[model samples]
Target: MSAAAPTSGPATGLLAVGAYAPPNVVTNAHYAARLDTSDEWIVSRTGIRERRHAAAGETSSALGAHAVRDLLTRHPDALEGVSAVICATSSPDAMFPSTAALIAGEVGLRGAAAFDVSVACSGFLYALAVGHSLIAAGLAGRVLVVGTEVMSGTVDQEDRNTAILFGDGAGAAVLGPVPAGYGFQSFVLGADSSGGPHLYLRGSALRLPAGTEMGPYLTQNGREVFKFAVRTLGDSAEQAMREAGMSTAQIDWLVPHQANRRIIDAACERFGLPLERAVVNLDRYGNTSAASIPLALDEAVKAGRFKDGDQLLLAGFGGGLSWGAAALRWWGGAG
Candidate 1:
C-alpha cells in the first residue's frame, strides 16, 4: 500500500508551549571548583554563567513529562485529542523503552504512538517537522512534541570542553490545526554526516562491552563543530526563508538552538538580523541539547515578547552534523 501524503485538511501549527528546568542550579563557580576554568573565562568564551542540572534520579523522561504537564495545565483540553507523542532527546533514561514512551505514560497518554527522535541539538526542529507531518498527513489530530535532555548525565565533569557547556532541561509544544497562513510556512532540514566524527558519544549498545574502561561520555572537537555550526545554521535559515518566500525584513523574531551565544550571533549576522531579534538563554541554561529551542521559545512567549501575527524563524544545528530551520507566523496564546 502506498503511504499517505501529509494531509492538507487544516492548517496545523504550534498550539501550546511549555518548558521546565530542574531546580538544581550549577554556576561557573561550581565547575571552577573542579575544572580549570573561571566564570569570566567561560562567559567570555561560551557566554554561559550558570545552568540547571537534574538532581539525582531525575532523567530526561521526567523532565520532559514535567514540561508536557505544564503545557497541559495551561491548556488541559490539549490532552483530549493527542494522538502521538514525539520526544527529542540526546540523553535517554535507558537504551530501550524510548523516552517518548515514558513521557507518554507520565503525561497520561494511553496507546498513543510514542517514540523518540535523536538529532542532538537540532532535535526540537526535527521532532517539530515530524509532528507537523503527522498532523498534515491526517494521521494524528494532535501531537505532543517535546525536546528534553539531562546533559549532566552525559558529560564528564572533569572535561572542560564538554562539561562546561551542557545543562538539563525540557520544553514541549502541542501541535494542532490552526487557521490558514498562521502556522508553519516552510522548513529546511539537512545533514552532513562527514562532520559526525567531530562530535559524538562514545558508548552504545552495540559497541560497548562488559568490563570495558571507556565510559559513556560526550566528546567534541569544538573548533570543527563551531565552524560547521555557523555555516550550516545560516544556510538552513536562509533556505527555509527562501522556501517560505520571506525576507529577513519580515521576520519578527529568531529562535535558534542555544548552543553558544557566539554561534547565534554569527548566524544572525549572516542572515542580516540584529542580535536583538533572537531569543537566547544559553547564558543561563548553557546548551541543553535538544531542549534549548523550545525552552527559549516558551520563555519568550510567556514573557510577552511575541505577539499575534508575528513572523518567527526557528533554527537548530548540532551533532549528526544535522541542521534544520522552520518559518512560521505566530498565532499567539493557546486556543
Candidate 2:
C-alpha cells in the first residue's frame, strides 16, 4: 500500500512527539548471568548493551499514556482538537477493549475514536499513515498516533534469541495540519506472509509451519529476519522517496527501526546513506518493536538535530514480514 500526495489544502504533519522507557534497566550483564553469553558476545553481534524492562503491572497502555502526557507537557495545546487515537502494538494488554481505547481513557480522550494497528515494528508507520489520511480527508482535526510495546511480557526469559534483543517502551506523535509543502510527502508499505515463520510471537490462532508448535513466547529465525529486514528497509525507503520525487541527497536523516545495529548499517549502505546519517539508539534501548522509530525520532527532536524544512525518511520492518517507509518534511521549530 502507498499514500499519494495529500489533498490540496493544509497538510498533516507531526505537531509534537514524545517517548517513555521503563526505569528498570536490564544490562547485558544481567542477561549474561542467566544466559550462556557474555556482554562482549552480545554487543559485538547486536550492539545492544542494555534495554529497559517494564516493572510489574506496567502495561502497554500505561506506557503510551505516559508518552502522550509527556507530549502534552511539552506542547500543551498539541491535542486540543484531537478526535482520534491510533495505537500500534503487537503486545497489547489484552485482546479486547483495544490498547488505543485503554490509552484514550488513561489520557482522558473521552469522545475520541480509538483503534489499534498490529503490524509489529512496522506498525508505527502504518498508524501514522492512517492518522495522516484522517486529517487529509477532513474526518479529523487532529489525531494522536502511538506505538507502544511491553515486549518483555511476551519474550521467553529462557530463550536468548529474543530475550537479548527486545525492550519495553512507548513513543507518540500528535498529527495535525501544517503549512503547505511541510508535512508528510508519501508512505509506502508492504508485506510477505510467506516470511511469517522468520519472526513472530506464537499464538494458537495462527497456522504453524508444519512441525512448529504454538506457544506464549516470541520465536525467531534471527539470521533469516536480519536478511529480510536489511533488504526491505532500504527498498521501502527508496520507494517512498521516489514517490515523493526525492533523491537520496535531499534526505537529512534516516530514522530506521532500532532492530539491530548491523541491520541498520546494512540498510543504510544499501540506500547509499552513510551510517552516521542514521538516528540510532539500540545500544541504550534494544528494539522496542513498534516504538523504535518514534523513540529515535523523539530523541533527535529533543536534541534539536532537525531544522524546519529538513527532509526525513522513516523506515521499519518486522513480523508479518512487513515493512513501511515514509518521506516527511519537518515543520516545527521546537522539539
Top candidate when judged by TM-score against the true structure: 2
Error of 2 at 125 (Å): 0.4
Give each model a TM-score: 0.94, 0.96
**Candidate 2, number of clashes:** 0
Q: What residue pairs are clashing in model 2?
A: none
Model 1 ranges with Cα > 4 A deviation: 1-9, 205-215
**Local lDDT at 232 for model 1:** 81
lDDT of 1: 0.86
After superposition, candidate 2 runs with Cα above 4 Å error? 1-9, 204-206
What local lDDT score does residue 190 receive in model 1, on the 0 to 100 scale? 77
Instruction: Give the alpha carbon lDDT tens digit for every residue of 253-307 in model 1.
Output: 9999998899989977877788899999999999999999999999998888999
lDDT of each: 0.86, 0.89
Per-residue accuracy of model 2 over 84-115 as CA lDDT, tens digit each = 99999999988879999999999889889999
